[model samples]
Target: MEKLDHIDLAILKTLQENGRISNADLADRIGLSASSCSRRLDILEKSGVISGYHARVSHKALDYKMIVIVHISLSGQFAKTLAEFEAAVKRVPNVLVCYLMSGEYDYILRIACKDLEDYERIHRDWLSALPHVVKINSSFALREIIDRPNLAASLGS
Candidate 1:
């Protein structure tokens, strides 16, 4: 990765706030010429720094009302078991995020559902049936206080 100068950081910060901001406006805001801004942005995108632009969609709007935090302990820590578990997890639609961890549990998952009934179905069908899963602990999130998607990008090194 290339070193990000102040201008690059400024561009990143602006883009993080509003991905749809026009190039000219972004250039003006970051104190760069239009051509320079465009070139820099192109470089950033091509180099995989600026991955993709997307809109923030609400899960509640999509009728996913409950967020379940799940802690999973696998049957074993073997490479094959872990790989199979991760692959199976990706196939489940309700699983929003999964993370391999270094703690009491092997993996943690964030699952979204419409309600308790929906979560129960997912738990019975998906969670229980997951490959090599030995134990599953789940907790419901009462409310989402904060959900920042671009914290890393905004706080550049």
Candidate 2:
């Protein structure tokens, strides 16, 4: 990947603010011709800098009222054990994000569900059954202070 120029940074910053912005509008904002902007955008996508566009949907609107932070300690840190755990966690419906961490816990997961009852069902049916899991600690979020889905823009700025 080539080093991004000022124009490239401007394009990224603008796109991060509004992913749905039309190419013509984006060009106008970034002081470039539509053709030039389109070319740069194409390069950004092709080079995997701009991975993909997505809608930021509300979890509340989807009836997911609770976010559970789960810390999991695995029985073993072997490759096979980690892989098996990851594969199983991917299949779990309520699991929003799973991270393999270098801490006391082997893995940490962010889960979304309707309520306590819903989370209980998910825990009983899926989370507890995950491979190599020796310890599971769960914490319920009372409120969300802030959730930034756009961090790449900060880098450009």
Candidate 3:
């Protein structure tokens, strides 16, 4: 990971806002020549700083109307148990994100579903069937307040 200089930071900030921005436009916005901007962008991509570009889509647009936050407590924290749990979670299609936590809960999952009935089905069929799970607590998100995929704030402006 190379240290980000001023130009690199500016490039990252601009790209974060609009990944589809043309190279020439990006260069103009950041006060860099097109060739210089292209080189820097190439370096950024090669170094894994600019992982990939993507279109942000609303879950609701895809018929997923509910977001559920689930906290899972495992009966044990053995390596095999954790591995099995993680692998099993990956097989579940509606589990958007899963994290191993350090506190009271063993794992936290963000799940998307169509409705309460769909969530109930997931809870009964998938979450409960996971190995080593002792308890599962779930809460529905009323609404999404903020969801930013950019890390521009870490660059210190």
Candidate 4:
């Protein structure tokens, strides 16, 4: 991919703020003609700079009141073991985000539930069933201070 210039950066910033913005408005914002802006967007998409867009939904409104962060340490870090664990996690509905990290724990998962009982079911039925799980620790969120994915903006678009 080519290095992004100021216009590309501006385009990314605008799209992140409002993904539904029309091409004409985007051109207006970035001081370009509609066709030129459309071409840039096409190139951005083709080059994989712009992956996709999604709407942010309120979990509270959906009655998903509990947030749990699960830290997992595996018995081993073999490729097969990690892949199996991740694939199982994908099948579990409550699991929202999972990250493989370096440090004391092998993996971290962010989960949502309706309440403590719901969490218990996930702990017992879903998470606990995984093989080669050496240690499992869970922390329930008391309050959500800041919750945004904090999408990349400083990467020069």
Q: What TM-score does each of the candidates earn?
A: 0.93, 0.95, 0.93, 0.92
Provide the clash count, candidate 1: 0
Candidate 1, residue 9: how far the Cα is off, in Å: 1.9
Model 2, residue pairs in steric clash: none
User: What is candidate 4's lDDT per residue for 1-157, written digit by digit as tens?
Assistant: 7998888888988898889999999999999999999999999999998988888888888999999999999988999999988888889898899999899999999999999999999999999998778899999999999765545454553
Residue-level lDDT for 19 in candidate 1: 89
What are the clashing pairs of model 3?
none
Clashes of 4: 0
Q: By how many angstroms RMSD does model 1 differ from the true structure? A: 1.7
- What tens digits encode model 1's per-residue C-alpha lDDT throughout 1-157? 6898888888988998888999999999999899999999999999998899988888999999999999999989999999999999999999989999998999999999999999999999999999999999999999899887876465755
lDDT of each: 0.92, 0.93, 0.93, 0.90
Q: What is the C-alpha lDDT profile of model 3 across 2-108, one tens digit per residue?
A: 78898899999988888899999999999999999999999999999888989989899999999999999998999999999999999989999999999999999
How many clashes in each candidate? 0, 0, 0, 0
Better-scoring candidate (TM-score), 1 or 4: 1
Candidate 1: regions farther than 4 A off: 152-157
Task: Sort every candidate by lDDT, greatest first.
Answer: 3, 2, 1, 4
What is the alpha-carbon lDDT for the whole of candidate 1?
0.92
RMSD of 2: 1.2
